[model samples]
Target: MASRRTTRRLAADAGLLVVAAAFVLPLAWVILSALDPHANLRVKTPDGLTLDNFDAILTPEITFTPLLNSLILCGGATLLTVVCAALAAYPLSRFRSRFNRPFLLTILFATSLPITAIMVPVYALFVQVDLIDTMQGTIFFFAASQLPFAIWLMKNFMDGVPKELEEAAWTDGASAFQSLLRIVLPLMGPGVSVVTVFSFVMMWGNFFVPFMLLLTPDQMPASVSINDFFGNRGMVAYGQLAAFSIVYSTPVILLYVLIARRLGGGFALGGAVKG
Candidate 1:
């Protein structure tokens, strides 16, 4: 029995390694292609490694402008989503009104609605308001779209923060808003971090929204700008595209590395409840 269990454990580990490699192999190919000067659709070891692919693509007009545009749009949208979600979540989490349940259900339903379904109306409204090709308008739409899911997550996180802490704060003459700022929010850091990262990632990877809304090339984000690497009539710069992708993806990778562990370390609600 002992020997059989040992064999099964080894088999499981081997199976897991295969699963891991399946995902890692593609990422490995992209990195290798980025370094290969003559990289094509087929990824292979560099015939002669060179930084020229990166150099050719890195320019203020082509790369930096779109990169900066992405950062601004994503950053602004994330900030808006996190703040609004937190405030909205706090009430939903703490209040016990009959309307709260139905309201939250509505939000959950909204989360499943595809953005494409609403784009026609959204674009028409943008036209009426003269917001076409505008960064602020894009950012606003991004935040608004992400708000339903962010609020749902925030509310669950806020719920994990015990009401006992707020009760103590109330005893000390602290207002509800004051308690939220000092006690509740501080304890829900992991939750907020998750929401912030999620919002940022969604906006950063978005292509269709910016592609449709932004008419001026100068206003395009990196997600939309990368399309230029695919030229008209059967031409594509694979090496340059790979290199640009690496640059485009670094911020999100760094952000996940920084906060990923905390994202799983949700509030120890039991301790707060006991306190």
Candidate 2:
């Protein structure tokens, strides 16, 4: 029995290491490709290595407009999603309404629904509203898409928090809204941070919606900018494209690393112990 258990543990660890490598290897390749001047993304041969690609993209002529566009869209969308989800989740978490479970289930269903399924309708609606190419419109669209999942995650985190904290605040003449603002929201920090990060990443990296809706070249997101770098009609500007990708992706990676530490324990259930 002991031998079997040891074998299983070894196998699990080995499997996890393999999985980790699988994920890391692609990112490593991206970094290498970005540095390799002779690396043609269109035609991948094994031997090319150089930093000219990074230098070319970082040069002032390359411009940082795409990076700025991504920041605006992601920042606006993330803020909107977190605020809306927090407002929505608080009531659902505290109330014992007959519709509460059904409402949450509906949100779960929405989260699972593929964005492709609604693309046509949403695009048409945006066109009708003359919002197809605007940053504000895109931000709202991204916020709405992320809200269901954010609310669900936050509600679950809030559920694990004790109701008595809010109740005690209420006894002190705090309004329901006040109790949520002063008591509950402060405690839901971790889960909210996770969802905010998720929403920001999604909006930042999204390509399809921006590709289809944003007609103007100037309004394009970084994903679209990268696609354009490769050129239309299958032309590959390998060096510039490689550089642009690295420049755009670096800030995203750095931001995640910075935010991850702050979000660590605040939202977890173990952090919910009475203070």
Best by TM-score: 1
For candidate 1, what is the TM-score?
Answer: 0.89
**1-275 in candidate 1: lDDT tens per residue?**
99999999999999999999888987987798899988877657888889988898898977899999999999999999999999999989998999899999999888878997788888889999999899999989999999998898889889999999899999999998999999999998887887788789878998888887788988889999888887542578788889999999998888766665554532432322222
lDDT of each: 0.86, 0.77
The parts of candidate 1 lying over 4 Å away from their true place are 232-235, 264-275
Model 2 clash tally?
A: 3
Mind giving the per-residue lDDT tens digits that candidate 2 earns over 90-194? 889898899998998899888878986787888899999999989888888889888888888888878878999888888899998898888888887666776
lDDT of 1 at 251: 88
TM-score of each candidate?
Answer: 0.89, 0.81
